[model samples]
Target: SAGRPMTAINSSYYAATAYRSDRMPNQPPSAERSWIRRFAKFRLPWGLTQEVALDDFLIRRKPSSLRFQEEMNKEREEKQKLGTYIPAPYEHVNFHDRHDHESFRFSLWSKRSHFWIYLTGGGRGLFYIAFVVSMMTYFLMLFALDDPWLTTTVELLPILATWIFLPLFCWALGALVIRYLPHLWVKPSRGPIWEINRRTGLVTLFDYDNNGEYKKNGTIGELTAPFYEFDAYIATIPDRQGLVTNVLYIAHRYRDIVINFRPLFAPGEGQLCCALWDFLQNYMDTSRPLPDLPRYEQYRHLDPTTAEYDRKTRRNPRFWIDMNDATFEQELYAMRGKIDQIDTFQRPNLMARHVEYVD
Candidate 1:
């Protein structure tokens, strides 16, 4: 009797709220005028930006309650497990090891392997071009005859022959090189080898024991390195002295340089490390003069320690902490407030006040 009465009371309360004063207005499907006015006022320094209506932007079109509950459940589970709650498709921060002694040696070999691969590719390409030119020359001579039908027939034969035979020949040549060239060029070195991917920015390193056997403990894979989209195809072979010394310097300077030294020479692994290392070194070298600062007047009052000063140093108005400073955490939190203010000013459309309509 008690359960039945409680259920009836709850149902009545739900029915009352279902058509309550909080219900949205049933207006005609038309563009929002206020949004148009805001859009007209919103002029990007570059030019007039695209218009986004308020109804379309602010309307809660999707069912959010269930999704929010699921997200909360996921976060609770992650927290209970003592794991940081990362959104789907998260990337783990890569940590480099500073303790390894043979890291530089492996890096050098990896760079050498990349150079060899590049040289081989260039040779093959030149050979193919020469073959093509030769075919074109022969066809030109053959087609020099006065008979139009015979010339056409000869041209067709050359084209067909090239399309079929050249590819097969090249494949055979490549197979031969792959099978025999490693033995010839890759000498029995007594250290770890590293490699880089030319297409993907994947890096690998492998270490060998005293007997020249690849040690299981030494094998490492998928070392993350800074690789730009364009660096995918090009391979750089570092000069023996310059590359080895620089790698050693980096390893010594940076306490955390997590890299697998064993798989460095494997295809597609070594070159990426070389490219990334070069880029970072160039980027971080304070010896290089800073570029001309924009909006320098806005940041003149704040000291270098202040977030406002740092924002002025860069055009993007984002604050970055100097890693070398002892009060990094304090500086970071101070910058966070400044960053929030900048974000609010830059993205005004995102900060909309929730409005409830009453009948």
Candidate 2:
């Protein structure tokens, strides 16, 4: 599986450092995490450190192969024919467009807060409905029925005050609590918890203690490693009902750092996760053109290798931008078929040349 060494981008020292072999190990073992540990890890907040072991399941270790490129190119060309071949970078993945071109940042706490809001908000909504129904019933009795027990304006005054003021006060208090309560448990992160930088070929993770407190002074919690120095894995976890959940994780080959962007992809998208792994390799490999997704279309020229490739091939600058929804859906359905046909494990690990492996 030995191949030509990576050529440094613009002969720059920083870019050259990404290709260093000293930090990588020869052979990484397949260490399956226990179901109990997986369950506990899933419950942990995102900013807290989740390190990897050498024995963790290893999926990808190097740049993608020609076969992988051919499959992706085939999908891109199919979309290009439909005029819906736009850049669908990480930012656009899972229908979220919050990320910038230089990096894709993800935070689990933000997602957790949203989950809590949905739950607590539902209960508050029921309370509002009950109050409305009760008020309607009370008014109907006082006006339409003309009941002897509810006759005068003075009697109505106290009843109306009770109905209006009590519900309004409760609703207002509930709203305030729902808005601020989650912040007390998990502090709103100052920035993204995980970031993958396209320009630097580096992946960074910010760590916090179990209590969700920043452990480092002046942002000392930031841990970064070369993109090529990590391996991808699928952590299959089963819930209490015996339903299995597949989570895609990336673990540093030498360091204890590990990160997952589960919120970016929906549950049961294991194949899509595999495709994402291939996309990351293509995007980070300076030797190849960037993945032809709609998000990267505008920034294609910024990457030296991608710019040169587009120039030599005369690739359309608006390939992804000029796409339509209908054709894009058609092409996406077909692309998934291609993705399913691919055997991610069939390809040899090109990391063999990039790192030394031991028995």
Best by TM-score: 2
lDDT of 1 by residue, 1-359 (tens): 00001112122212221211122223222223244323312111110112111111112211233245457777878786987655532123222321111111232334444455555665567667766876786667666866685766666676656664654565555556655665433432334344333212223344344243345454443323321211111223345454521121121111122343223223232323333333222222112211111111223233122223234345344222112234434443543333233221132221022221110
Candidate 2 residue-pair clash tally:
13
TM-scores, all candidates, are 0.23, 0.56
TM-score of 1: 0.23
- Candidate 2 residue-wise lDDT, 162-278, digit = tens: 666664655565567566663433334355677777667789887665234455443426789877667776767675679887777787767777887566666564565566666
Q: What TM-score does model 2 achieve against the real structure?
A: 0.56
Tell me the RMSD of model 1 versus the true structure. Answer: 26.6
Candidate 2, residue 138: lDDT: 67
How much lDDT does candidate 1 score? 0.32
- Native-to-model Cα distance after best TM-score fit, residue 113 in candidate 1, in Å: 15
